[model samples]
Target: MLGDMTASTTPATSARLRTEIPGPASRALQERRAATVAAGVSSVLPVYVTSASGGLLTDADGNTLIDLGSGIAVTNVGHAAPAVVDRVREQAERFAHTCFMVTPYEGYVAVCEALAELTPGDFAKRSALFNSGAEAVENAVKIARVATGRQAVVVFDHAYHGRTNLTMALTARSVPYKHGFGPFAPEVYRVPGSYPYRDGLTGEQAAAAALDRVDKQVGGDSVAAVVIEPIQGEGGFVEPAPGFLPALSRWCSEQGAVFVADEVQTGFCRTGDWFASEHEDVVPDLVATAKGIAGGLPLAAVTGRADLLDAVPPGGLGGTYGGNPIACAAALGAIETLRTRDLAAAARRIGETALPRLRALADETGIIGDVRGRGAMLAAEFVRPGTDEPDPDVTRRVAAACHQAGVVVLTCGTHGNVVRLLPPLVLPDDLLDEGLSVLDRAVRAEAGR
Candidate 1:
């Protein structure tokens, strides 16, 4: 249904099953990957993808599966989007890498300009590009420290910042991300984050508890920055209750600590807003962004108050490939698509279509403990029937069932009991409906079991 594909095209069908999930061809590739790939680099589904377009992925065995994860919230405009493809091709032909740090280019400056206009601030802003979200987050911390002349950085519970040594200290999870990766960076402190579903507290109440801990344990005045994801990502798509962000931001201002919003997963219209902080009218001093910024290219940025970023020395904040020309080109095209298509509203329509269905499913299935999220980023948390205890086994089964049925779904959360759906904003309504129908039956069967 993207562009003008004929109905007879092999991979153009909304969703098709040519063979069993991970059919023979994919199984063969799996055997090859097992021998060469690292054990820690795991994938949700083992199917080997050959090509992707719009909402469908054509696998090695000719199976066409619907994509619900969007490469972990990348490809938001859609896979191989025409605008992105064109820009990438044009940029590749002209030039690829002339690192922005050595020989600055317009694409890099243009992307920074776009970030200035698009991010949730009307004040003068500056940005430094990076190669990944982790890099951007680390750089944001560096900028905050340099600007505020403080050492302590405060993060929230159930947060997933990154996997780098410094970011691992900033991250709250253990196991796969931070386990055995000590000793981490120093001066990183953790406090409570708002989770209305589990904590059962109003935004102001949760904020007070967190602020109290910050003041008592960390001493807010000593804090360089308070970093948070407007909505938690890998710890589950936990959108904080209303007013929590505003309260923390005000506290940061009063305490002379910078407020940093990690918008890596919630930015670029993925949450029906350019940045999630806009939802609560909260303006952070620095915002780290990535994932959906470049339509699949690896491009990250730390955009914030000009004074904060300007405080850092020139050589103190750059990398060899921080803003690769090709990635910047891709970002420009992706941003253009988001603006022209009004994908922010499209994301809202996606939420409108999917949330009700997910909520109805929650009501029908006792295992579904909660259903929450915004825009195209929604999730269903699984729990043992009649209890709030997490049911990760059932969650895995449901996701496996969806995969076998030619639908790709991803699971997240500290307990691994969440099924988070992040469909591309450009996905056709019929494909989304069909994918949801498959998910519905999968959940019903698994819950019935």
Candidate 2:
């Protein structure tokens, strides 16, 4: 029979490397995964995780590693948060799924209500739940097209929407996400977005250039939606310069196109705000949210202007398990944790603590080209010293060293030379500092090499 698992399985707060990162147990699991799992599915680290709590992930080989990526910004409130777990257990005991489309439930409605309240824009708002961020983005696009009666959609450069067919078309990267997955959806256009680090253009300048392209190529009037990430995620933690997002939003408003903010990675207190749009006081016509929503449960939502969402027919905008009851319960718990714990402030604190350290590291090592991002969603871009040329080799080496030392870091960017950090907001200060120290050592070692 099962005994008390918590006492035996709970990992310590600090990182403890029991063996080499992908120790014998993890290597064995990797062999099994190679046999069974598809090659397409990839993992950042070879260390197979058995359990995770707070800011630590316990691997199969009895190693506890500092969780800097937060499962790619999905665990803002931390892993296995008590409130979320309790709520999930309660909801599961009562009812796991009724298929909201078949028989509607209160949890779904409650989550919608929460989204409407939390998402930016003071006007009357509504939401539709989905299983993933890509689905939410797709639904938002559908709503935009239906409302505006237009076919063309505009996405910015360096955007990373998702992996689905339509989202793959929306995405800008060509190597992995969109390489073999071609013959993409039609009516999607890409324009220049403000990359202050690389372009050296002010936000307004970048917006004007992008708008010029839209007018010349896509025709602003024919555009149904102007979709963008307030802060790009997989394309790098590339936050647009000041005034860029606001200008694009204004242009969309003038052109009769819905401005959609894809906040899949930046929402839910990850960026020191309810949504990244709030940072610029830019209210989007529609917002796509997921990742940190629901404390790691599969929940994504499109929340925005009520009129646009309601324009669709009654039968539109729903899926079989869009808002599973258990997921909804967990979302409620996660939302409560955000509000009561003031995790938004926690995110800000993380920024305050880490940004200065990262900047100092950049100063010490010229290879660290740029350090940017808000709140806990921070990144360090790597380039060859004394030149703008990207050095992905240095980035990979640093990440590998950090991994060996028990800090789980992630690399991203269009050029693949950026190391991004997304530590959970709930992490203790000492553990966060420890993780930073490991990162610092890794970067220093790479620079020396």
Distance from true location, Cα of 361 in model 1, Å = 0.8
Clash count for each candidate, listed in order shown: 0, 0
Question: Cα lDDT of model 2 overall?
Answer: 0.92
lDDT of 2 by residue, 1-449 (tens): 01112333444768887677788999999999999999999988999898999999988977888999999999999999999999999999999898998998999999999998898878999999999999999999999999999999999888999989999999999989999878999999999999999999999999999999999998989999999999999888998999999999999989999999999999999999989999989999999998899999999999999999999999898988899899999999999999999999999999999999999999998889999999999999999999889899999999998888889999999999999999999999999999999999899888887
Candidate 2 regions off by >4 Å? 1-11
> Roughly what TM-score does model 2 have, to 2 decimal places?
0.97
Off by over 4 Å in 1: 1-11
TM-score of each: 0.98, 0.97
Per-residue C-alpha lDDT of model 1 across residues 218-243, encoded as one tens digit per residue: 89879999999999999989989898
